[model samples]
Target chain A: MMSNTRTAIGVGAVALACILGSAQLVAAPKYEVVELAESGTIVGIVSFDGAAPAPQKITIPAGEDVCHSDPIVKEDVVVSADGKLRWAVVSLKKPAKGKAFPADDPEKPIVLDQVGCRFVPHVAVVPVGRTLRVLNSDGIQHNVHGKAKKNKPVNKSMPKQMKTLDLTFKRAERIPFVCDVHDWMKSWVIVSKHPYYAISAADGSFKLDQVPVGTHTVQLWHEKYGTLTQEVTVAAGKEARITFVVKPTEAAK
Target chain B: MTIQKHRIQLMAAIPAALLTITVLAVTVAAPGCATSTDSEPVADLSRAEALFVENCASCHGVSGDGRGPMASLLQVRPRNFSDEEFRYVSAPGGPPTQDDLVQTIRGGRTMGQMPAFPYLDHTDARLLADYVRKLRETGVAKMLVVEFADDDEIEPDEIAEIAEERVAPGDPVAIVGPSAEFRIDTERGRALYADNCSSCHGASGRGDGLDLPKDELGNPIEVRDITSGRFNGGAAPMEMFKRIRCGIPGTPMPEASALSNDEVWQLVHYVDLLAGN
Candidate 1:
């Protein structure tokens, strides 16, 4: 009775929230695992077709001798000369069915480091139910806060010591993290229930394997650019190749 | 919208909507640590103020200032909602974001004056959390955007661009508050604190030293006790360095221009000791 009423409120709030910045008020979906021996792969490259705008110059505010030993620029969009976009999140909007429970992938912990007061691996992907090891190596205090919609959010302070904050995500979502201490610092942590999610490389290429063969909604998200979605079909044991082109901030207008 | 954008909108809704009691019929929409962006769905605000006045007012005060009647008796004072700094905020190093306030309010701390209020039902607790967040957000907004005219307020698109110019890289920064950090023995730091800081910060690093300072409003500002565990300039070494090097504006805490990079680092160690870390 209680949860039923709550769902009603969530549903009612969704329309109002969408108007205010297209916020995702709809309760993010939960993850379920079922075994599937026959799986396919989704591989793609994220690139910008038009001219890449100059990087945003980020001010360190303080800690010049340490935080920004060198001039640091915000990586809102890291587009190389070859048109490859770095740090783009490529994920399935709503993953229906894919691989089974407890993927065979090595259970190595995903590492997120605060080196130079910045999140190393500016963009990363982790499977749901897995813990991400958040390390503070800069020997300076840094805080880790995630703005998550579907999964649980974390707001923890990492002491300068080699402390590891183990945070686990229970659902799938595209989460963005920031360091309140260093306002310029930002990163994205994308979570997926199955092995059908990947972050684009510095060269803008990404590959998602072990996906159940079917048509699925693929989405690309960038902190600077809003979001774009597409539908593609993955054949049995075949690699479905896709290309996503995002609008750079300057060109978007 | 992102969380930051919600801060602007929240300012308009919270104060006026204080008595509105916009309750969302939901029990606790969020399951685990799930959080949402701003543009929060409007809900009935109830027992929040009532619960606060009844249970929390003794320590948090009627207006949320750390000036409850029991405030003076306690070793660590209650939080001052109007103050700009809040150490336990959910946001990283900055002040507590709305969700942070909710979590902290729900799970009150063990060591300090904040006693966990498990008695408040999730719905009642959330109502109270929203009210507490409104107070903190109002205070932060006033402090951060005082210079801009009401009509000329900073917009979403302009923040990143403005930061580039106002907060240039490589420039010495003004310190704001404390955060968690690394530490070693404070023997040398203890000496440095004795020589430089103790006169104002107290021998034990509590802000109880002689010759206390005052803010611009002529209110007597107590010297910060490192042990109190709340900081105006975060607790991290760099945050401490930012404070030590640049110092707080319009206060008796002057910058340590003479101290070298290594010397300031040592001072941070000592201060942590005073905090009983």
Candidate 2:
């Protein structure tokens, strides 16, 4: 009887140890997965409350022609209908709850090109610490001049057939790109530290993904138009839709 | 009996240990401990004011008036701080446009009384320009005079003739020479320049043409102020002639290939008078 009792006790102890070991293994993996669920998505449209005006042309002085030929469409700057606020930059002023995306690499920068005296894209989304490649596709020589107040000013020549020139933005800036060879050519590149940003298209659509589920603020920015902010609550596994209306201010007019 | 008791104890402790571990992990991973540093305070006004006094007071006046002791001596008085009317502008009005102010301070108004403050560094120049605008707002000083001239409206010949009339024979080479024999049609040149040049270069050739745009980096590319004698690369008549014909490499000023060589010379001669040469 004594031997049987001792045997039973030893078996119970072994069983308990195995169960605890399995629990530890299961708990460790689930912990990391749960952290990911906290992240959510942010999406919305940035539309003009009133009439969107036709594109206007702005001329620079004779001596300072960085981008000469193309008519610069002031798209980023938008005016609200109320006409009070103007020239606002809408961005995620804070980081999200979880791990942030990796910082951009400066040595290998994303390139922005100018072909036929036109900036390739009307808008550019760049990560901070990453290099921006500027290419001149035209036969004529062009100067790639950047007007960033905080970052270094880039006024280098892009000679004909020049394949590429690399530039890095150290700080966040909405930099304007001009080609002195062609006056009307103009474009904007937005440098951001965080990856959770999207510029509204001409039709006014934007999307921000992988946001942690919870209450958060979404910011809307217009070049001429002021900014509008909205509070949103994101639920787990559901797509959240929000709309932001920006009124034009008198200053924008 | 002993075996049964020990089994019960292990079962109870397992749940409790797991709970404690999970709770601790969640607590450590929570984001509340991370503080946001985005709202850090900018430079204090006193520091900015001292910087302004040290660098800008020489030209923009200690009180933000265009009336520093250097103001009276400058050909175009430093922009009067009291007037609040900024003529050389790209944006119509909203705050003195950063581009105009930056360009004025960095590149200096070409041939104008304002000299480029490149020594201030771009960042410092920007901060100083911002401080100046604040001064304008606080009414520390106001622009007392507002002057506007149509450069295209006045011809070199007319200006030369006016200079001739103003300066008797050889009166120390006044801005306007007194040589009656050098008479040319000021009206025709004014019309031509107004129609062709004023769009990019302001009506007064002050580089403050209408609706100027900011550069990619948000810096203003100002029109060269031809009325003042300071030219960026060179001020010689031949240099002006070459620029008019070939155009400057990085600027908006285009080469007037459409105009004849002689016409470029006429433009150059007219530009010289506009420079007060």
The 0-to-1 C-alpha lDDT of every candidate, in the order given, reads 0.57, 0.49
Please give the C-alpha DockQ score of model 2: 0.03
RMSD of each: 14.3, 25.5
A78-124 per-residue lDDT for model 2 (tens digits): 43443222333344435434435555565655667776456776677
TM-score of 1: 0.51
For lDDT, the strongest prediction is 1
DockQ of each: 0.02, 0.03
Cα-based TM-score, every candidate:
0.51, 0.44
Misplaced by over 4 Å in model 2 are A1-37, A52-91, A96-99, A102-109, A249-253, B1-60, B63-73, B76-277
Cα lDDT tens digits, model 2, B109-202, are: 6645666777777677666665555444223100000010111112212221221121111111112222444445566557546645665566
| Model 1 / residue B33 / CA error / Å | 26
Query: What is the C-alpha local distance difference test score of candidate 2?
Result: 0.49
